[model samples]
Target chain A: MNPRLSLNQATIKHADLATALSLTAEAGITSIGLWREPVAEVGLGRAATMVSDSGLRVSSLCRGGFFTASDPAERARALDQNRRAIDEIATLAEAGAPGSAPVLVLVAGGLPAGDRDLASARARAAEAVGDLAADAAGAGVVLAVEPMHPIYAADRGVVSTLREALDLVCDLPAKVAGVVVDTFHVWWDPTLPAQISRAGAEGRIASYQVGDWITPFPGDALLSRGLMGDGHVDFASITRLVLDAGYTGDVEVEIFNQELWDADPAQVVARVVKAFDETVAGQL
Target chain B: MNPRLSLNQATIKHADLATALSLTAEAGITSIGLWREPVAEVGLGRAATMVSDSGLRVSSLCRGGFFTASDPAERARALDQNRRAIDEIATLAEAGAPGSAPVLVLVAGGLPAGDRDLASARARAAEAVGDLAADAAGAGVVLAVEPMHPIYAADRGVVSTLREALDLVCDLPAKVAGVVVDTFHVWWDPTLPAQISRAGAEGRIASYQVGDWITPFPGDALLSRGLMGDGHVDFASITRLVLDAGYTGDVEVEIFNQELWDADPAQVVARVVKAFDETVAGQL
Candidate 1:
């Protein structure tokens, strides 16, 4: 019943699937989030079995929705690709055995290439989410629609708020559609506490990812993410809010800073775990 | 009538007040936005007289509200400082002479140092805004609460949306409190069109600033702005929206790119004016 700690693969981008798995297991973590590229590299079947046998859970899958392409042919290709992603999550969840409902984190793709129509892009993404409902439900995977920061709205995902993400799938059951609570993305949201409470009330809180907002953000701003206490995000309060929203789920510490990535994987893991313990889990 | 082109001073950061004034006037621009620093550098009286004699309208006074300090003494100091900003804007309004209702754009400052409570910061800002109601009304200056991009919510300004800004000043008369619609800051908002319409309907459209959203943003991020057509912002539509909302005011071009700053002041003015003509005003 101790707070579940899940390591997001991107946090250790250099680590291969084998090394990542072994490291997470060695760290005494029961859950490890999987990224599509790494899982595919290891072969989904092999990856699933490795995770299964290792007794570590696949807490979530790092994406399967980019339904914003404006071209008809490209849109069809995107849907087909998403179907395959859903199937992979389903298979991984099945292999992980009892109680493994691996959430498929869907990063609503940004505006279609060279297109400036955000409304249309968002509409297309919403429609695509509905189209995948049957496939996702059939696979017993929840579509965890994630809202990236507005900084990414132009060329990244159109879904950029918890309310917007939830509204996209309000009709679907919690197992079919939910929202990912990534503190790094949603921490600046003024209405987040209310939205988190609403998300909990609606039973659509899919996954919780945590990273702090550091200052003097990197030139490549995505890598500006910091370990919990290393930046401005009030983890204890947000975690409390998430917990209050009935999210007794895996607390994924997903830092993507260059210094962290450059550090020895073991050292990075130890440092991150210690930070999480002090900043998030220990405080709770 | 000619879509009143006004150059924001930050768009030509390297230029002295006199150079910026002459270049803008020579470019046939009828109005110019002023930042407090450059105006102060030239002596406010001389600067005001120069702007008045040059026959150029003062479009807006670039900022006057940072009422989010956590300390009681700091909060009182901030209020007093903003009163001076209001007084300065009033003097500029007076000096701008015929056909000028110069707006005082208020950037609600970000959270206080070492403060993690955004809700309190926002509340404090809201309160500070109300405190300025009397002074602003007396000065004949509109306190335009400009909502910054959410990325700045942590340390720059807590007002991150037009709706939030409007809510803070909705009860105040349009002449007392208004909102600045900088396309760069609010273009990503899904409810922008509606919000723009609302701002116009409420007569709270204080100012309209234009800048495009170029990618591979600069290290500072603020200077990543580009000319109208150089980025993904759909200025024609946004301009149309603002026009529809009854904003018959100067359309301020406010690019903050380092390259733009390094360019010859006159040349940058010409290029921006050309870009605006083609991408925004021409299309509109």
Candidate 2:
């Protein structure tokens, strides 16, 4: 099969879900990753139908899991919300072609209430994931845990390394746990290549996302992502490592650049495709 | 030694060198870390005389290195500049009290222009250090290589890991090379404790700096550092690790906040001292 190309809807967050889907399809990208707000905005039924009609593959749902809260009520609410997100992903999967289910990507929450006890936050995140995994397995959706960068260890996600993420996954049932390898988050990790290999050997490789690294930007919390090749990230090397890790997943371009968002969506898509092509060529 | 406290001059970049010295001494900080630009601005000889008159220990010189340039001319220029910095440091040492010379903190340069070979840049940095080490040793000063954050791997310093920095030191002449453990650059590293121990075992730890991590602000470069306790960094744990690593040096409070810079210098020094006390209390 041809190398699948997935466009994360966040690449065009300014656009509505329909516009993002239509634009992605027009660009000949077969797969897409959706954010929850757009799914809710368009209504899950309509969103699912639109995705089905557009002939676009739902590569993975954007996220589910903000489990680092200190309050028990907040934790329960997060789990409930995750269950709904999983249900929505399942709906999209069933509505799609005969045998494919969209993967649900989970961003385990950072320190709840901005508390700095990273150890406790990590434990809570792991516990939340185990709970979410059962529901995800029942929904027939693979849950991909995306460990964020360390700079976000305070208020975003406690799991900062692929090794840490894999450890968390090990606690959950294999049928419900996998890992998402995003270059933007894990590129600087010295142990990345080894972790990628370990993930592949353990059958935990779920999604491979791509973006570059730009400095002096906002905190590591979500923004500050560079367009592929625009910054210092060595994309080709990371892509090669992930591919070698037995990850045959779509190469999703998930940039969160304010500058790119300001530009024409078509131009942005075209530039990304070109960069992806060059990155692959350079790697091979 | 009373756990000598030094004010890294960048903490008061807004104030002139004389004002910074006066404020630091008045605040009971017995040592000061001087930056090259400020020394240059006030004339190296004058800056040295001022410190001597104030009876302040020059803890570690602010910087010297941008060695990883793609151009040969630029690299040579940097080397020449480092030699001059060494000469200036020698002057500071001669003017300092009887037995001590200020440690020259080396910031190994970032990636060369249009060249993303981090490994190569690191090699060049090591070579530059070797060249400067001879002079530094003869001048009765120690050359301390500071491994910056990985966020600066592209533009500021290629030495991102303490292990990497220690490895580079192995190539230098014995007793001439060491490592600077800066909390702001290394607090996020999972390998920090082990590296610090290794640095101590090898007698290669030269300096230990502290700063916090705050987000939503631009912290890409060496600047943009948060004040101690204001961010998520676990200073107590790190300080213990450093102490365990055999480092009895001053726990310098090095904050790079514009807000603090705008405030009264006396207030800033008082806050730093308070933070230090709290940090030490927690650690003990």
Q: What overall lDDT goes with each candidate model?
A: 0.85, 0.79
Q: Model 1 segments beyond 4 Å from truth? A: A282-284, B1-3
Determine the iRMS, in angstroms, of model 2. 3.3
What are the per-residue Cα lDDT tens digits for candidate 2 across B95-187?
Answer: 755434457888887666666566677788888888787787877667889988767777788888798889889877546789899888887
DockQ of each: 0.66, 0.35
Instruction: Give model 2's TM-score versus the native structure.
Output: 0.90
Which residue pairs come into collision in candidate 1? A110-A156
Model 2 over residues A72-154: C-alpha lDDT tens digits?
99889999999999998888877765434467888877665546566778889888888887788888888889988776666
Classify candidate 2 by CAPRI docking class: acceptable
**Runs of candidate 2 exceeding 4 Å displacement:** A1-3, A97-101, A171-175, A215-221, A281-284, B1-3, B97-101, B170-174, B218-223, B281-284
TM-score of each model, paired residue for residue: 0.97, 0.90
Q: How would you class the docking of model 1? A: medium
**Candidate 1 residues B1-284, lDDT tens each?**
24488889899999988988899888888888888999999888998898888888888998788889989999999999889889888898788856566688888887777788888899999899899889988878899999998878887889998888999898788889999999898888887988999999999999999998777566786667888888778888889899899988888898888888888888999997888888777634
lDDT of 1 by residue, A1-284 (tens): 23388888889989988888888888887777888898899899899888888787778888788889989998899899888999888888777636566688898887765678888888999999999999988888898999888888877678888888988889888879999999989888877999999999999999999998877566786787888877778888899999899987788878888998998898888877888888788545
